[model samples]
Target: MGGLEGEGPDRLLRSMVVADSRRGQGIGTRMLAALERYACGHKVLALHLLTNSAADLFSAHGYSRLDRCAAPDSISQTAQFSTLCGSSAIYLCKTLSVGD
Candidate 1:
C-alpha cells in the first residue's frame, strides 16, 4: 500500500506483502511497480519505507539502504516512524523520476 503522508516530495510505502502461500510469484513486485506509478502520478520525487524484513525484495527493486536519520522530517515525524516501526527497522529509499 502507499501512504501519501506528509507534505513533501516523498511518499511512504507503507506496506507490501505476499501471503506465504502466494510467495514466489511476482505479485509483490507488480504491486510495488503499480505503487510507484501511482506515486509518480502524484508528483512524488521519492519513495521511502521502513522494514525489518523484505529489505532484499526492496533492494532488488532499486531501493537503497539508508540511515533512518537521513529520512526527511516529513517522514521521520510519522507515526510509522515514531511509534510503529522500531528503531532497528531498516530504512530504504528510491529516488523517482517523473515518468518512472
Candidate 2:
C-alpha cells in the first residue's frame, strides 16, 4: 500500500509473529504488507516496534535499530516499553512514506 497524507491510526506496531510451522513461506512478508497497507490508509507516518527477536528480519525489511534509552517519548513511554517488553529489548523503527 501507500502512505496517507495526514496522521494515521496507531504509531506503534506491537508483537508481530508467525507460527514456527509457518516461518519461511513469505507469510510474514505478506502479513507485514497488509498491515502496512492498513497503516497507510490511516496515514501513519512511522511505525515502531520493540522486540528481542527478528533483528535481521526487521533490518532487511527497512527497520532501523534505535537506542532504547534514546527513543522518543511516544515510544519510550508505551506500556511495551515500560512493562511488556524487557529493559534490554531492541527498539526498531520504520519510516513510512508515500507509495512505500
Candidate 3:
C-alpha cells in the first residue's frame, strides 16, 4: 500500500485498493488513515499519489489536486510522475505537519 523511504527523503504510496466485495465498508479510508499516520511518524513532509479514478476518495481524505506540470522536484521524479501515471492521471498531495 505504501513504500518506506529507505534511501530517500520521501515515501511513495503507489497503489491502494479494497477488494470489490469490500467496497463501501470504509476499508480504503482506514488504509489511507494508517498511511498518513505512518508518514507523520516518519517525519515525512508530505505524501504524494496518483489516481485514475479515486480522486473523490482522496479529496474526502484531505488531499488536494496538484498540477502535474508544476509538481515539486521531490515528486516529479517518481514513477507515478515519470511513467506509470499518464498525463491524465490525477496528482494529489497531503502535507504532514508536526503533531499530525
Residue pairs with backbone atoms closer than 3 Å in model 3 (clashes) = none
Better of 1 and 2 by lDDT: 1
A best-first ranking of the candidates according to their TM-score comes to: 1, 3, 2
Q: Clash number for model 1?
A: 0
Assess the local accuracy of residue 46 in candidate 2 as a C-alpha lDDT between 0 and 100: 82
Tens-place lDDT digits, model 1, residues 14-94: 867778888788888888899889889889999999998899999999999999999998898899999999998999999
Q: State which candidate, 1 or 3, has the greater lDDT.
A: 1
Task: Mark the 10 consecutive residues where model 2 has the least summed lDDT.
Answer: 1-10
Over 4 Å off, model 2: 1-10
* Per-prediction TM-score to the true structure, in the order listed: 0.93, 0.83, 0.87
Candidate 3 or 2, higher TM-score? 3
Backbone clashes in model 3 = 0
Pairs of residues at least 3 apart in sequence or in different chains that clash in candidate 2: 8-42, 8-43, 8-44
Query: What digit string (tens of lDDT, one per residue) describes model 2 on residues 1-100?
Result: 2222223333777657889999898877887787777787667778787778777877888989988786667766777788888877788888888676
Q: Pick the candidate with the highest TM-score.
A: 1
Candidate with top lDDT is 1
